[model samples]
Target chain A: MNFILHISKLDKYFDNLHALNDVNFDAKDGRILGLIGQNGAGKSTTFHSILDFIKYNGEITWNGNPINEKTFDEIGYLPEERSLMEKATVQQQIVYFAKLKNRKANWTKPRIKNWMKKFDVKGDLNSKLKSLSKGNQQKIQLICTLIHEPKLIILDEPFSGLDPVNADLLKQSILEAKANGATIIFSSHNMNNVEEICDDLVMLRNGEVVLNGSVQAVRNQFGKNELYVTTPMPKEELRQLPGVETVFVRDNEKYKLKLSNPDAGVELFKLISKGEYIEEFSQQPPSLDEIFREKVGETNE
Target chain B: MVKLMNKFKAIVQETYVNQVKSKSFIILCLLPIIAIALIVIVGLISYQNAASSGNDDTNQIALIADSGIKKSIVQKDGDSIDSSIKTEQQAKHKLKNDDIYGYVKVTKNNDKYTAKYIGNESIDGGVRDDLMQNLSLHQNKLNLSNNNLTSEQIKKLSNKPSFYNYVKSRSNDNKSDDNDIKMGSLQLLIYILYFFLFFYSSITATVISKEKGSKLVEVIFSSTTATKYFIGKITGIVLMMLTQFAIYLIMLFSSYAFLSQADFAKSFIKENSNYVHQIVSNLFNINLLFIIFGLLLGIILSATAGSLVSRREDANKAGQPVFMIVIILFVLSIMFQNNSNSIIPKILSYFPLSSYFFMPIRMINNQANIYEGLISLFILIIFIIGLTYFISKVYKGLMLQNNNEGWFKNLIRGVKYR
Candidate 1:
């Protein structure tokens, strides 16, 4: 069962402000799609439209049919602003949310311990949600979202408050869910996490899809214009070189060069290494972080 | 449809279980019972105090008069005078010893009589009044005989006219014997409905606002339709209210059953069986349907108010409109409970909000017929259904909203978005 969530020509208006404008994307099964943008870039709006939490002008369909109540049972969502019933114990909250997704408590109950262990949650099942730290409460919320084994998973800022260790644990769980053929769409401000985990990426800018493709493809579209080299070459000489637009010393012995044309990378690599073995020499397209900044900066201009 | 229903059932179960376990719910449910118990305990203590004080000999008064006058007065007002104290000296001795509450002395003149009541303090007003009336009557008898009036004339002059009261209504051909009891039961029903509407509506509003204020509603809305969720939540709250009412009824019946075995309760029940029957019979009728539908309207409107707020702290303020409405209906109902035939109450009897109070009162007063009650109930049901639908339409937009806009502004936005 390869489930695909296809959102096409989606438009949403909040009074006079256009929140989402003809946004289009697809999240395929067994893959994680990262939605990346700066603040107020319509990433949350896109997720809201997909979940049908707000009215939109276009169609969002699961597989071939329109998303409906039955589809919702197979879908899991975690809102950007993390919240859970503070008065409920961890076990009760998880079971209640799972039940809302149409999963039985008996089935969810036995799996709570395993999920708690997997997420490395610090609190026990009976611990009140409010008693736990913010990170632990988020972990419990994540467990609730995923416990029902939803075919379509949507998470907004799932890693915003997590420490490195907890973030890694969540990353592992997300990958595991992906391996189980879940179509997962998550929005995040952390480019490293997106680069490390996302199979595909979509960048929204002011309610429009500015960039959308597989992670590599989206990056490759910008070409391999960034170069790193560990050389004895001075920064001024590198700046004067053909196709070298800018050069900056990155470390004690390392230099980073930006190429006006990607082909300039081969020449720079040859010149920096002099056909000899170098300690570090690499040329690649800009990172997701740089691309995100470039795209957002372009819109800002 | 099955899946939708399943989700609806899940929401209802969750809402009911969560709220039923809350400290607020438990406290609210027990508050009335505790209050009722306190009242009963206080009443019992007061009654016992009165009974014990009644048994004290010092609470009795003695009268000093001629033997003939004493006999006539004792015959007129028995148990009032302490006949054992026959003379002023003996009464004074008993009073000095704190045995007698007071003493009254009667003196006769040529055409007038004087009675003085003496004690350590002022005599009991009731005893003083009785003594004065007895002395005056004795004087009247003596004067009548001296004036040469016959015994038949005195007897005829002493006789008083008889009087009786009756109430008639269009519903009953005969005069109503239990009008007072029926009116009392109607007032009681109105009060119960008011509490149910006010308390449960506020609860519903708070519950909805709590979810909306947080991000929880987004997650919930994703799993179910807004209509289903709203209906499920209202159903859950209504069921909880019903459960609380059931507990009250059970407590009441259990208390009754337990007390019925006691001699005092048995005699009381036997003495007021007709009143009890009237109260119980008033509870089972088309008025019940109006109460239920009226409660639904209140809960639904409060839910709408709850959905309009962007934060949980605003929930109480959001419920104010509904609270004011309930208060207004209660005041109007009480004001016209007896004057059910008036045009204002008649008009209000058909309106959904006031009908719960007025229709029952009118029916109990026989100012509204069974058909009129049923028609009012039908209108209320239709109003509830329409309101539920309208609120459901706007509920999704309202829940999704997260702004600090004024409630009316938000409501307009919600309608526009819908």
Candidate 2:
């Protein structure tokens, strides 16, 4: 797939402190690119630079031409800070945002209405934004960002403060954007959603890209032959098996084992049979959360 | 340019509509009416008390003296004089019965004259002073009559070379009095105007800046040029102010119409009836026009400054200098009018802030001609608009800039920093 955006040797600094150092990245149309990092690891800084939040050295080109700010007329940005004018009404605010994206009011209003309805936000067009709950306000902001049908959307922790149902609702909306031929840049601390949606991703540490690629490929690239078993057995009994490097008990019913080779699973099967009949055995890929901890050594896990 | 202008018009229309519909805008408009009504009600009560205080203006005072003495002390606008009275007891009884406010009991005591006066608690200061002066004059006349002074001599004594002053210069006696009143009124008007402007613009500026502080500006900038958005935002706010002003004007007009028939109604204006006709001739004065224009300029310029900051708190801080400058100019304008034709007022009349308050007053009294006021007004307006444009440019640049930059440092960098 042809890359929609390419950034190379991109650098930024704040006085004596180097903020973004020689970052290299790529993204394609119709894809969701996840960005993961610690609180201070420059994920926000990168998104900001793309949106011209800061002036930086080096180049970030869109479709081979340098990304000019004027091109933002076709882009939507949802900042993680979660901001909106409380004084304005829901429809007035939505229309204003849509206007910024070059949409006419007559055309924009109905679309915002449809989005609000789809999200199950029941309210009149005249309801003040301040009266809405935190979750509902967030939904309004999301609707604002998504109103313009932008080609490129940057959502910085858009899932924050959302309940699981709302989060799922937002995820589906994002998938809908992808289906509509839009490129989405998603930055977050939550790995599960990143695993769920991101076709490719990068983990940054100390303003430098540490790991990058498709989540599955990257996990396998940093492979440790690991097996997670769910069996009705005690952890002490599983720990005594040969070829099992160690057994980490999740609870009474399930256990995770690190293996030296693919054949090490046979030893787990024998242990399972001796103690309690094995409920199930399957070689599952390491969760993205686990892989991130091992690579970045982040303590979030 | 036309495209941009059209966009600006659209923004302005939206702003005006929204602002007029806003609760705050409605309140701002209603405040002036409420204030006027309250003032009128309070004024009516005070005027009633004052009008009834001295309703008995016909009470007579007696002077026990000669027939010619009555002729010398006869008041032109008062009741027929009481020619003579016997004693002080009669005077006290007359005062108590409201037959007389007071009376002077004159008695010849050797060479020098001695007099005793009786009055009630309700006696006025002007009447008492007049009575005392008349008694002294009567004593002088009696002394002259005893010396067998001729009528020609008395006439000569009365004419003490009264000076009738005249001047062809811009400064003249009558003009000077007019200048003081004009200056004071002009200064107060400009101050009120500036206060209203600041109140309106600062709130809008705060709202705009909050968008940046809250990251709303950044999100909007993602889909449009910051310059366009900033221009649109300011345009919207100004339109709102205009709407508020229009509503306020309508309310004032209606209130005036309603009050003009009342007994205590002092017209719809805080000015003399002749002011409307008199102000016409002064309208052409360049200096006067300049001063008014300058004041308007100050409002616009200060508003532009107010909008340049990225936070509501920052706008308050940034707006202080502009506000102080407006107030200073307003004072200077008043000074210019009060000290008409003086070196200080003359010089300040050409100054940006000082001129708006001074010109109208000077022009009305014919202290300064129409052309001078108008020319000054035009220049001041241009200066203020230019300054506002520059400030707007700075605001546009900083709207998308890293808000972490401190206000003073960012200002020093001049809207662009690598």
Model 1 scores a C-alpha lDDT of 0.84
Q: What is the per-residue lDDT of model 2 for residues B1-418, given as tens digits with 9 covering 90 to 100?
A: 4433443454555556766777777777778878987979887888788778655533567665544544555553145335445566776676677776677666667545666666664444565566567667777877787788789988876786779887754333466555555554555455555576467545655555566667776776676555565566666666565566568658866766666666676553434434433342333345333433543564455444544565655755656656666666655655554467777777666676666655555564467776787676776777776765766656545655545455555555436633
User: Which number leads on TM-score?
Assistant: 1
What is the docking quality class of candidate 2? acceptable
Per-candidate RMSD vs. true structure? 4.2, 6.1
Interface-residue RMSD per candidate? 1.1, 3.2
State what share of the real interface contacts each candidate retains.
0.69, 0.55
- Please give, for residues A175-252, the per-residue lDDT of candidate 2 as tens digits: 999999888898988999999999999888778898889888877775556777787667776777777677788777
Model 2 TM-score is 0.77
At residue A234, candidate 2 shows an lDDT of 74
- In candidate 1, position A261 carries an lDDT of 96
Clashing pairs in 1: none
Of all true interface contacts, what fraction is found in model 2? Answer: 0.55
Q: Which runs in model 1 stand beyond 4 Å of their true positions?
A: A274-277, B63-86, B104-190, B259-280, B334-342
